[model samples]
Target: MNTTQLDYTDITEIRGPLMVVRGVDGVGWDEFCRIDTGDGQLRHGLVLEVDGDLAVIQVLEGTTDVVAEKVAIRFDGAPLRIPVGDGWLGRVCNGRGEPLDGGPPVYGREMSSVAGWPLNPVLREPPSQPVLTGVSVIDGLTTLVRGQKLPIFSVAGLPHLELATQIAAQATAGGEPFSVVFAGMGLTHADAAFVRDALDDRSAAGELALLINTAGDPVIERILTPRLALTIAEHLAFTQGRHVLVVAADMTSYCEAVREVSAARGEVPARHAYPGYLYSDLAGLYERCGRIRGRPGSVTILPLLTMPAGDITHPVPDLTGYITEGQIVLSPQVHARGVYPPVDPLSSLSRLMRRGAGPGRTRDDHLDVAAQLLGALARARQARELAELIGAGALGPVDQAYLHFEDRFGRDFVSQRPTEAHTLDQTLERAWQTLSSLPRRELTMIPDRLLDAYYRSDHG
Candidate 1:
């Protein structure tokens, strides 16, 4: 359909970011459109739907001054496309991919659809390589793997943003050519500034790219933030053969934008007024990460979303948990205690931890040590509950030891300085030091050989 030759003046209704045109022909869904206001202003849009002679368009920029009688629409007959290339590295841009660093425009080597294709399951190589995040809790516990989609489930006021930035500054792809694409959705101006400052070193080093959408930006632009990021990442990982790590912060805001648009469209709402297709919509973004067989690079995702009112059952986090491989749950309780990451090991998991850790990948004893540490932490939690009811005086000797072990674990292992990046060996050594406080009899999860090699019985 050559929509350029056909202009429509039949905008029958203008409803909150949406405009409906009547007597339209050969219009297709998702085709780009340009809305020309009578007073020399233009707005870009996408055809949301087309039925018979009626077409619905979602205005990319909000419809602030659009008059139904004087508006004209021209369809481009194509979905939204973004120019992508290697030149995007070490650059900063807004959610829509416009330069925010006062730099020149990105001269793209190629242009690609923001709506990426799903990887065939048969072509996906099982994610196995460890992506060392330099955080002891993550590297030693919930190991992030190459091509894995792992999310950080957080609450308001927690330092998930700080943690995400720290990971971006320190994570590695086993000495491979690694890159990071950070997408900040609906962030405040101060938060956006914080991200730029925190990642300045990485950006200066040409290892990071930032895409930020502030709270004041249009809601529709927030919806496109992650898509633009993933499109660029796909180009980097597949075409350029660079292992790319995409960090998307506050996806809850993105979901809310989705819900807002859904409301404007008058679509039937599902859970919590979110559209029924919320699951598939989120999957479309997360499922884009993986290593294709015979390809030299992979795309690993770490999407951070805050659960509204600390409710995990909220549609956003709930659906995300189902799609991603696992989650790193940040604990308000631990955060209140002043832990840097506040990662609740009991609540957090990495499904690919086993495949990424152990032997040659990280350490031979990583799997065993992590299991023992978690088991000990569980006992410590139980002992703390008992002490709360019966007082520490009534606790048994083993219970007392477990309490001390827990204190050491949180202070030494779980808590780290924001800039302190630990290697796999340093992390493992700290794990062993924390576990050495427990009695040898309680260390059943660790093999005897490992105990003799790394564990110190005298410290127990």
Candidate 2:
């Protein structure tokens, strides 16, 4: 095969899907290639957007004049790959792992496929370890189990993107046995940039590998991007025993891609006009996160998907709620009211909370503090609604105190410093401070010792 003809045969358009060009003899799919255009300009491209035996090339510079007649693909004779050496600890890369932050190419090392395979069960370990994200609402309550697939359910226009960044920036497992693989799907360029910048600010550029499928990229690529990302993660986690966190954002878009492809193949529809196999498809991804039995490494997942019209019953979220551990639900109302994470505590839950929280994992008081605060706020919310009919002036002292408790919970404990990353201790201390506003007798859920120690700081 000629290395110089931009050589490929059977260049056919899938109409709206994308173009697939079959390499003449030994061209690689998703490998680096170039096309000589109308006026002798070399256009850099990647082999993809393909069918069986046909490799698709997307010209990052856009295809205008380059056609079958003059296009020549240089098959690097390998799959599109990136360097995963330790140098990745302090560097940035594009969705494809190309260094994007103006660093030199990750040089002179072996290359491997970004789309990796699952680990063998014999070498895997259970994800019984806790990975704290420094958010009280998360770490203290819904502790992130290392190697667990815990998804965040959100609606559009919520701060889910920003929230994901915070999780990426602050997440830490025991003994520092953790890394991150961030897979963004159907995100806008700006959204992608924000996450990148956030990671940069945290000095976490290298520890986290980003697989981005921007909104403008072909839909098929979005589907491929996460699978590729997880594949790479599985390699690092099980093979290397490095606990890896895989964060896939906008899984709704991922599902939509599934729907589109299914429709393209003319399949029957399920609830919410999604494909019928949505549940199993999601499980195929989510179920991959876990300790395999005895391997030192693990891969935890935080897959984000938006619910249409904020509907939890929507098939995407509904199926997700069932297959995975509990969820961190983002509420638009709370977000618009100026909460940073905008996590609706009442609605969110962590089913594996018991295993992940305790003295060693976190403070022993973490669980009780969470419970007391949640219960008090729930009561306060109830009291405030009652005051609407009975009048705040007529309500008893406990009821009024409940009202005050509700306000402080929303304003102080639930609200967060936009720039500051709060540790689990700080979050709990702040919760205690807010809870201190209540009378001692009302602290039913909390143990008496904590109540005496923490409840009295507010000497009224």
Highest-scoring model, lDDT: 1
Each candidate's TM vs. the true structure?
0.97, 0.81
Evaluated at residue 329, the lDDT of candidate 2 is 87
Query: Which runs in model 1 stand beyond 4 Å of their true positions?
Result: 1-5, 458-460
lDDT of 1 by residue, 1-460 (tens): 6445578999889888889999988888877788899889988888888889999998988898888888988888788888887788999999888899999988786889897877889999999889999999999999999999999999999999999999999999889999999999999999999999999999999998899999998888899899999999999999889999999998999999999999999999999999999999999999999999999889999999999999999999999999999999999999988888899999999999998999989888999999999999999999999999999999998999999999999998999999999999999999988988888888999888988898886452
Compose the digit string of candidate 2's lDDT tens values, residues 1-460. Answer: 2354345545664333434566455555556665555477875555653455676665544554556555555555555565554455555554455566777865525456654444455655655758888766787567788777788999988888888878888788866667887888888989988887788744453577766678886666666667656766776776678888888898999999878766654458878678888998787777777777756777889989899998899888999988888898888878887877788888888777777777676777888888888889889888988999889999998898888888787787877754567777788888888988888888899888877676654548
Best prediction by TM-score = 1
Error of 1 at 199 (Å): 1.1
In order, the Cα lDDT scores of the candidates are: 0.92, 0.73
**Candidate 2: regions farther than 4 A off:** 1-13, 18-91, 102-126, 203-205, 457-460
Reference-based lDDT, residue 34, model 2: 55
